[model samples]
Target: MLTRWRWFIAVAAACALPSAAQACSCERPSGDLHTQLRTARENAVAIYRARVTAVDPAAFDGKAAVEVLEVFKGPVKPGERLDLPSGGRGACTIAFKAGKEYLMYAQGKDATSVSLCSRTHSVTPGTESELAWLRTGKLPPLPVALQREAVSCEPCDIDLVGGRLIVAPDESPSSWLWPPQAAEAMKEGRPFFTRAHVDSEHSLIVGMSFDGKPFELTQTHEYAAPSACTRRIHLRWCKRLDVTTPAGSPHPVFKCIEPGESSLQCDESKGRESSWRPPESIPADACLWRTSDTALCTLEPRMRLLPAGARASPVLKCRPQDLDRRDRNHFCQVETKPGPTDKAP
Candidate 1:
C-alpha cells in the first residue's frame, strides 16, 4: 500500500497524461484532493471559471464559446471569449450547453478543446471545494463524511547508527521482532539475516528486522534457468530469490549460495545480523516505516511518529466521499470525533 502511495505521488507530481484511448475509458481522478489540484494546475494548458455563451448545433463537431468569468491559469483574461470543442459522439468528447457555468480544464495553448478525461465539469455545489482551492490556493476542509479520527499504532523508533539500521522494539501488538536468540545473535554480529517477501506485481520487497523496522525495497530483476537445463529435468529448476534495497542505494550485491544460484546479498552487517537502512536520499518529509505493517512517520504536517499497535478502535466503515475514496480491497478512515481517551499522551 505504501508502494502504491509512493507511485501515486510520483505520477501525480509529474502530472503525466493517461494513455491515449480509442474507446470510452477515463482514468479515475486521484482521491487525494491536493493531488487533484496539483495535477490540474500543472497538466492543463488553460483553466477558467466561465459561462457558455453560445453553442454550435452541429452534431459531431459543434463548438461551445465560453465567456471567461475568472482565469485561474494561462494567458486568457476575464471576459475573453474562447471557442472550445463540444458535442461529439466519440469517446472522451464533451457536450456543453449554452448559458451554463463550468470549470474548464482546457488542452492546447489556444484552449480550444475540452475532454471528459479532464476535470472539466459543469459548475455546481459539487465543485465548490475545487473552486475554493483554486481561488485561495488552500485546500478546503474535507467534508464531514470524509473526515476521520487520525489513527496511530504503538510507538517504535527506527534509526541508522554507524551505517547500520537499528530498530528499538517496543511491546506494541503489531511489533515484528526477531526471537530472543536471533536478537542476541544480531547484537553479537553473527551471520544472521532475514529474507524479504516479494510482491512481484508491485515490484516491492518488504524486509523485516530484529527490532521492528520494515525495509521497503524497490528495483528487482529475475533470472531463469539456462537452455542447458532443458536437457536435464532436474537442472531445469532454478534457485532464485528477489533481492531489493532501499531506493537510491548503491546497486545491491548478489550473494548466491552456489555458483550461479540467484539471490540478493548486501554487504553491510551489524553484529551477526544483516539489517537495511531507511532511504537516506529521500526528503525528511517523505513517509518512512515505523513498524513492519502498522504505522509510518512523516515530517510534513508536523513530525509525527506513531507507534505500532492494534488500532485504537474498530475499523470505521462508511461510504466513500471526497478525499476518503478507497479501493475495494482497503478500508478508509471514517470520521470520528476525538474522545477524552483519544488525546495524545
Candidate 2:
C-alpha cells in the first residue's frame, strides 16, 4: 500500500508539469540533508547499493549491469544482477564504471533508468551520513560546535571596507571569485588571503579568485541601493515655496517640510533652476531613491550603493524607501532631524 502511494505521488508530480519540456525541471529540492533523503527514498522506485559488474559503451546510449548488495526499496533480491540504462550525452546522463560500487536510485520496474540528477553517486566516505539514514531511518545529530576555517581571499585590485568591496563594479580593480568552497567562505565572511591588483582606470569588473572561480560583474548606469531609506524630503505645503539660502550662489538649494501628512509632491530644483509644480500622492508601497537632497526622488528598489572612488556626479542618489510604514517613517525622521553641524556649536 505504501509503495502504491509513493508511485501515485511520482505520477501526479509528473502530470502536474505544464509541458513535457519541463518534465525534468523539478522544484528546488528543499529541506535539510535528512529530509532530502526521505524525499528521494519515497520517490524512487528502486534504491540499492550496487556494484557495477559490466558496462556496455555504445553510441548515444550506454548500459550497465549491476549486482545488488543492499536493497533499500523494491523487490530485487540481493545478488541479483540487473541491466540498467546508464549513460547518455544529455544533461541527465550518468556514467557507470565496471568494478566500481555506487548507491543507485533507479526508476521503472522492467527497464530501469538512472540519472545523474538522482541521488545516485559513487560510494564515498562523504555519503556515510546519507547511507546511514537510508538504512536506519535516523536523522543525524548536529555537532556541538562547528569549526570554521578561514578562507584566504588574496586582495584584488578593488578597495575593500569592512571586508566588503568598497569600489563599484565599473571602477573596481581586477576582481576574482574564489572557488566554490572558498566562495562559500567569503560569503560567510571568513578571512581569505590574496595579492591585491594594482589600481587601474578600468571601470569594468571581471576576473576569478586564486582558486579559479570566475566572478562576473556587468557595469550599468543604474546604482544598486539598499532597502533602507536613509533620507526623505517631506512635501506637505500646498504651494511650492522657493526660499533660496544666502540669496544666490550660482544654484540655491530649497526644501519644503510639512508636519504630519506625507505628501510626495512639490517640484524642487535638482541642480540648476528648471521648473516648479504642486505635489502628487506617492503610492503606499513606492520604492523611491533620492537623486539629491533637493532633487526629485526616483523609484530604484534594486539600486546599489555608491562604492569608494566612484565618479562624482552633480546629482547624488540616496537609499530606497523601506517597505514597512513605521520603519520608513522612523528612518526618515532621523534623516530629516538637524545634525550637530546644523547646531550653533
Best by lDDT: 1
How many Å off is the CA of 279 in candidate 1?
34
Q: What overall lDDT, based on C-alpha atoms, would model 2 receive against the true structure?
A: 0.38
Angstrom error of the Cα, residue 220, model 2: value is 33
1-345 in candidate 1: lDDT tens per residue?
Answer: 112232222221122111112333444434334555676678888888999999886534568888999999888899898888775333356668889999888865556657766667788764676777788887644322111223222211111110133333342223222233333443465422232221111122222333433333322211011100011110111133233332432323122222232233321111111121111111232322111111122222222222344233322222111112132111222223312323321
Kindly report which residue stretches of model 2 are placed more than 4 angstroms away from their true locations once superposed.
1-27, 108-111, 142-345
What's the distance in Å from true for residue 6, model 2? 25
How far residue 279's Cα lies from its native spot in candidate 2, in Å, is: 48
lDDT of 2 at 179: 30
lDDT of residue 162 for candidate 2 = 11
Clash count per candidate: 9, 20
Worst 10 residues of 1 by lDDT: 225-234
